[model samples]
Target: MILKDALPQGRITGTGSLRTVVQTVFDVLARFRQYMTHPGNSRFEPLFEIAMQKQLYNLLLEWLSGETTNSPDKVETTAVVASWGIFGAAVQWSRDPLHSTSEMMVHRVSEVAAAALAPVLGE
Candidate 1:
């Protein structure tokens, strides 16, 4: 469920398909998590993350280059960057088992999306 769906009174002040876009971002992260923590997985987690990150960055750059006045690209960019940052943190956490930065990244993304959704959802 997305922040807008979870918080009915919330608003989404971003571009089109906010819920769908945000959900996809979350789903990508979920796949990354599965690859990272699972035991005996054939797919290498690091390579998977690197590939995911590249795809995200490419999409973001494309969105940025588009000449739309009201672009969802900005929000998309934020979501992708935050997601990758957190993924990196998760990798570190697994290695050293120290602080958990991945969780922090999730929170940050949620916060932004919540606020962005607030206006639209409140309508």
Candidate 2:
């Protein structure tokens, strides 16, 4: 429930593992996509993009920093890489109408991310 605890109330609420975090991220991305698609909010798309990336990056940084036992440099690298991977996957998920839902996508992303980070983190 790390992600649930970290996110604001009503954004993402649940208790689980990395799937919870991925689902929360997907929910956030879906909300941002909705906001950006609004005609009045279109002008702020660039700012929203940056904010979303920063938010994910910070969240990953904090999460990985606590989860990993690696050195500072490795942890930082892993966090950056994982954040980008997760963010990129979320972006793609938003674009694909057929796969827009979080049910399968979130778990897949979580598995891939966990696999990628496992070796580096010595988990």
Candidate 3:
């Protein structure tokens, strides 16, 4: 429940350091991968209903707005939307029979998310 824990807390940090944001993103993705791979869970519907997702998106948008001097709007929107897609893909990747491990899926998704947000974060 890392996402649940993180989202309810609000902003990742007051300074909004790019490193912190990136790590947070990585952590979230990792937790998601863990949840998806759990033996008891077979359906994806419950994950979508978690309020944490919306809160996480809003937090990212807020962070993006504060961190970016130019094109904050564009960056926030793209990052938020791209993150949703990336997370979805990560879930799907976890569920895929070909993927042997959740760890690999988490790493791949985290890398892609970092690359996608790096520019906007000014890192």
- Model 3, 8-85: lDDT tens per residue? 354544323333444454555556656767786647646553554565576667767777775866876865775575
- Displacement of residue 108 (Cα, Å) in model 3 is 1.2
Candidate 2, residues 1-123, lDDT tens digits: the string is: 334374565232222355566776788767778777767887886786677767666766666677667787887888788878987898789767474457788878888988877766566
TM per candidate comes to: 0.42, 0.76, 0.58
Instruction: List per-prediction Cα lDDT, in the order shown.
Output: 0.48, 0.70, 0.57
Q: How does candidate 2 score on lDDT? A: 0.70
Where in model 3 is the C-alpha error above 4 Å?
1-10, 13-52
lDDT of 1 by residue, 35-121 (tens): 667686646766766765565444433433343334465545554664465345444444553354544544555566546434323
Task: Give the best candidate by TM-score.
Answer: 2
Q: Return the lDDT, model 3, position 102.
A: 53
Error of 1 at 120 (Å): 22
